[model samples]
Target: MRLALATAVVLSLFTSPTMAEPTVKLHAAGSLKAAMSDIADLYEKTHGVTVARAFGPSGLLRERIEGGEAAEVYASANMKHPTTLATAGKAGPVALFARNRLCALAQADLAVETETLLATLLDPQVRVGTSTPKADPAGDYAFQVFDKAEAFSSGATEALKAKAFQLTGGKDSAKAPEGRNPYGWVMESDKADLFLTYCTNAVLAQRDVPELKIVALPEALSVGANYGLTVVNDAPQAAWQLAVFILSPAGQEILASYGFTAAGAL
Candidate 1:
């Protein structure tokens, strides 16, 4: 995707001795903080602009927009929120920008074998953690994993459900705690015994604490989490420009480098 960008000029009207650039505010997924910070610096240097950012779970970001939050560009860990906004004519059609996967991250010594990840979560001694399902793909993906396991191994499923304590499954699961996904409870940093997070978030969190070990989900149960970005109908002018810039090859390259799967691979 090639975009024709306007070139910059050397102006002496310099209050800052450089081009006075427009600043854009971006609301992004919390898991994307590391990669976004790296990408933002490169973008700011290339385009002579500044990108101010706020990061959190996708669900929180979505509700913010629905309630009339002022964000020109909205990027989420999943495409659904953007699509919901687009359907209501609040945001542009969604563009899948990148993708990630859910992984179980546990203390290094407590890490379980790959083949037993699902079973390990069921063990009473092993406490598993995850994000809020309605608000996070990782949280929902965790439920899918458990439900799939439930169909194949009823006892394991039941035991794990008991251990997990609060899942909100499709219908049978509604009885789950009002805001919790039994298999993967809605958790953030320090919110659970074992955090269920995307690979990116795990990587970023490790920079703060190095004791965590990432456990890959079983292939039969896990699904990839795709991310998307779009321009909100009411975004400010600067936000629009930054949104456009992020859709280009330059932005995709940065996203892909940080363990994200990019668009067009299917």
Candidate 2:
């Protein structure tokens, strides 16, 4: 009877429903923290699985993934980073999950709009801020917007780059005070008069400080940001399930609520 009981216990351990679920490790971009965290919580509540998340600049996270840090899912601020991972055999196929556009966040009284945008940044008295290039996709897109700015007026790219302050997003950007958006924090601390960042981020910051305004970028200088999602090459089944959920209507709805556009809506 002891031998039979021991055999039954071993079989039960293998077949238990509670033990069937797997915990997935998700490495995602900093901008995704809010939306992804909420989605993960909802997913766990409904599926009885857990999601472990690590958030940082997409490029830095991609480097870690390339270095073989154990992650099951990768969501990047831009499609290029995930595509690079897949090209290096570190991740699976890349999927464009959402899109964003660059906008200017300014003090309540700052005179900045699409019409006066370029002139304001060019003014020496105006303090312009942006993320750090290469280290963060937001910064890279900011610079790309500057490149487009060159079209409206010659040498606008170099001029904007020279005047823009690398304030919030960087390889060594300091953590903002708790419950504060980095851009808003910088603006509130008098570090910058205008900050160029994702439109979604601008909206989030406005929630923290109602006085902050989001100025739309003109079509000539607008830069579109594409968010990508991919599973690691050896990711568990749960990772793929989460990825599918993100692409599902429910997930898309959550993203839309957070100011993100449908993947092709740009």
Q: Rate the local accuracy (lDDT) of all candidates.
A: 0.64, 0.81
Residue 213's lDDT within candidate 2 is 90
Error of 2 at 63 (Å): 1.3
Over 4 Å off in model 1, which ranges?
1-21, 155-162, 165-193, 236-238, 264-266
TM-score of each: 0.76, 0.89
- What candidate 2 gets wrong by more than 4 Å, as runs, is 1-21, 264-266
Worst 10 residues of 1 by lDDT: 1-10
Candidate 1: give its CA RMSD in angstroms.
8.1
Q: What's the number of clashes in each of the models? A: 5, 0
Clashing pairs in 2: none
lDDT of 2 by residue, 161-256 (tens): 999898766767877897888777888788889999999889888887889998998777889999988877756566766777777677787888
Residues 119-210 of candidate 1 have per-residue lDDT tens digits of 67876777766556767556666666677787657776556545553322122332324333232322333345566667776665565456
> CA shift at 217, candidate 2, in angstroms?
0.7
